[model samples]
Target: MPFIDEPAGTTPMTDTAAHGAASPWWQDRTPQEIAALAAADGVALLPLAAIEQHGEHLPLSTDLDIALGLVDAALPRVRAGVPVCVLPPLAVGLSLEHSAFAGTLSLRPETALAVMVELGERVAAAGFRRLVLFNSHGGNKALVDLAALKLRVECRMLVVRANYFRFAPPPDALPADELRHGLHGGALETAMMLHLAPAKVRSGRVGNFDSLGRHLAAAGRLLGPEGEAGFAWMAQDLNPCGATGDARLATPALGDRLVQHFARQLARLVEEAHAFDLARLDGGALDRAD
Candidate 1:
């Protein structure tokens, strides 16, 4: 059943498991807790990450690890009584580009979308009317946007798909040489892993991979792993190493700074987006043709 409309104020905070109770924040909770939270402060943060290859040095779960890390970091900044539950990170995503690499678990775009839509409906039904999809993997960006659109129409829930990097800058801001865009396992990502999970980052393994460094230097963009120097999809373009950019410069200090800055930016975005008005979305203005 749809939740009853709450009075303008008098919302309550949900009780955490720490209070001698066992209801998990995301999976299960009492109806009174949900209603009280909806009245006081209603916002849900869904951490989205990929379980794909990040080269030999990083673990397959690096993206999800960092995403969960952000959730931990942001909890304090949320409203004191708000029921800010960190939904389990979606650990698998569209990784067709990195399929050549071992241990890369790729999900069809549609599957990813379906999972998010289902989760959105459940949360909205439980009175978490404001939903934010906090994404850690780049590949999940488009699909998250699609899921947000679908959820808005079907569930009337406000879903915002946020990318951490979209709000934050790299530590020392990495000179232009490093900013040259590539696909997987690049400088920014490497630095992030180093900061969030230092034990997992493989900085020494940067060598013997990606000859396309020279091409990126010369062409200003990665021309794929083979230096093909042409436009192509992830599967056709990237190589088997699961790396696209230089990882040599990645350091734990750099990673720490990146994560801190990223967290600050994301916390601010969540606060601003928390009060966002979804009914104002101009869907009628959109044209099918680009």
Candidate 2:
């Protein structure tokens, strides 16, 4: 489905509707208003992020800010027919790998799972049948996958676990090796920060780090030649700065492209999720072995 841009002079539904405005923000609506919105088949977007170190050049809230920025950019682009409610972000996630670094706050994997499950349950109870777990941090991927599965069974809701970076436009200016292995505090992330929050980025402090080599070494050990299996590793093990990739190559122009690309894809996902048919699936059709 194509993204629908609002026509000029048209105000958001939030400004004119009594069932809470069409602002697409959960925090902006009252409890009663939310109840009404839930009854209207609104989809709830919950941003999952981490408060961790992003090297000396970037602020600790890099993931959190990027998640929120993506949401802010996408909500407006959602088709007018889909009513979306953006929930306040869960900033602290599973970041134990980065705990060795200062300014890194993390929750254990189990704790993070519990928090996400409870949040999903609460939102499901609030009359929302669609919940999107929008994650920005790499460490939170496993937690989100688990939560999405359990929430589907327990809450009986359509849960979507989306990683923002997965929607980013491929970097043409950077090398394929760097783009593939630079998972954190890298050129992609730094550029995103430059576009979303330039004040928090220390451009002068940015430098190159060789995380790709470490990542490959770890992958070779944990993952077989086919890259099927995985092993555990810490952020420090990858690089001294607790970051990967080359940050010195980050530019505001690249950041803008990334942000816009991610936002557009995210908006499309939200629209599709809102229109998904949860009742059509045949749960009993497949055998466990199949």
Candidate 3:
């Protein structure tokens, strides 16, 4: 799938008519229209984001903006056979690590999980068989994973959880060392904001923080180098400003490339979801090992 790069400021909400009647945004269509689409095996995309702080350079709505931007970018390229529609985004997520920061809003893990599961159930009840939980915040991973499982079991529907950044191609311009630790409000994120919402990025205040030691230590404790130890830590513990990489290296061009790459990858996933057969696993018998 190819991504069509629109000029800066051409947002999804503003340009719905360009997609014609096959638009993927559910909010743009009436309930009766959605019902007709659902009868044809349509899938729903629910963008999950966080209203959290992103250092001094990025806006508090950074995650929400990126989540919507990525979904909007991918929707036009979705396979014609799969009628994927995007639901209004769930913009508040699990962001306890950023709770100390001003303007940061967070939901407890259980609260987030319950909200997602309820949304999934409601979508399923409305006759949609598939629900994609498209997440953009790292803090929401645990909740999304758990909610996906519970939704599938309780709602008896296909539920998928996708983290947007996981589909992003690595920055070839940066060193491998920098790539290993730049996970938050860093060059990658800043560049993305520069391309998608430059007005919200404080380019003059862009800076860098080498947090490799803190990240590795946290990873070793939580995930374990050899899978042996575990612990908990907050963003404040790693960096006072809550940023993790060299934002100074970010550029609008790089942001554009990253967004296009992520959109292509996401489109492919949406295509695959359309063809998956849930009935194949419905009546299979378990074989006992001899």
Candidate 4:
């Protein structure tokens, strides 16, 4: 069944089990608690997402919700007593491609990079040695990678940059063509939104963006990780609705499956970050190759 239409943000976002209900959020923790956690090899998860259009259906926070929700869901799956804290979401990111659409917001690339570094520096200053930059928006991908490298050098922290969707393989149910064409505002995103925040997903507003398919096919270009050659395109270049892909096939059932799968994979990723040590890269690491 389709979700009932509701205004954006009608549903509350997920909170954390990594810290537990007593102090589920990083901002809620006292300075002593934070420092103690940092000393325990704590890994800080920072979610970066864009406030942008997702056709006429999904909320602007779609990316943010997924990033945050996945973090929230994954936390408990981590073995008990692992020190990981999720910061409040950054909320806005690089959305230049969707800037033409109503309700879209973006930051300049340099500003975005600076903000990420500044946040990482503060985390390090607080004695944390690890940072996980969890991003959900496509536009933020390259910048997130750059931010991780910058944090590695500038903040002296073990930084891991990643996208939520990349953690798990796409569900086998998704068609092969969609694997390439469903770039944004597609079945995958819509389904996730349907599962994560059903109230925010408008019923019967699904749009088809086969035009983007035609455009991509004509250019002999590819999108996403499985590509050889990529093209520079704004969200509107391929679709007027500010959407691209076959969202008509999306369903809450599929969304539920994705949420579980993605959350499990993300939990594993967080565990890896928690165990990783910055000191491992020291001791003349650059001079040695194994």
Q: What is the C-alpha lDDT of each candidate?
A: 0.69, 0.84, 0.79, 0.80
**lDDT, candidate 3, at 201:** 99
Ranking by lDDT: 2, 4, 3, 1
Better of 2 and 3 by lDDT: 2
For model 4, give the RMSD to the true fold.
10.1
- Output the TM-score of candidate 3: 0.85
Once fitted onto the true fold, the runs of candidate 3 whose alpha carbons sit more than 4 angstroms away are 1-22, 168-173, 212-230, 283-290
> Compared with the true structure, what per-residue lDDT tens digits does model 4 show for residues 1-290?
11145466576322343444656468987676688788888888888998999889888989988887787788889888888888888999999999888899999999998898898889999998888888899899889899889888777778888797676555586886765678888888888888889999987788777656556576765663225756677887777887878888789998888888888887888888876644566654555443
Deviating ranges (above 4 Å) for candidate 2: 1-21, 171-173, 212-227, 282-290
Give me the displacement of residue 154 in model 1, in angstroms. 1.4
The total of clashing pairs for model 2 equals: 3
Candidate 3 lDDT (Cα, 0 to 1):
0.79
Give a tens-digit lDDT track for model 1, residues 77-143.
6654444656667788877766777788988878878888898888887777788899988778788
- Clashing residue pairs in candidate 2 (N, C-alpha, C atoms within 3 angstroms): 13-22, 14-21, 14-22
How do the residues 1-290 of candidate 3 rate in per-residue lDDT, one tens digit apiece? Answer: 11245566565332335555655678887676677668888888999999999998999999999888888889878876787888889999999988888999988888888899898888897789888889999889889889989987887777888998666475475665555566679888888899999999998889987674446666554552112453354776667888788888899998888888888888888877777676643654435221
| TM-score: model 1 vs. ground truth | 0.78
User: RMSD of each candidate?
Assistant: 6.2, 7.0, 8.6, 10.1
**Model 4: colliding residue pairs:** none
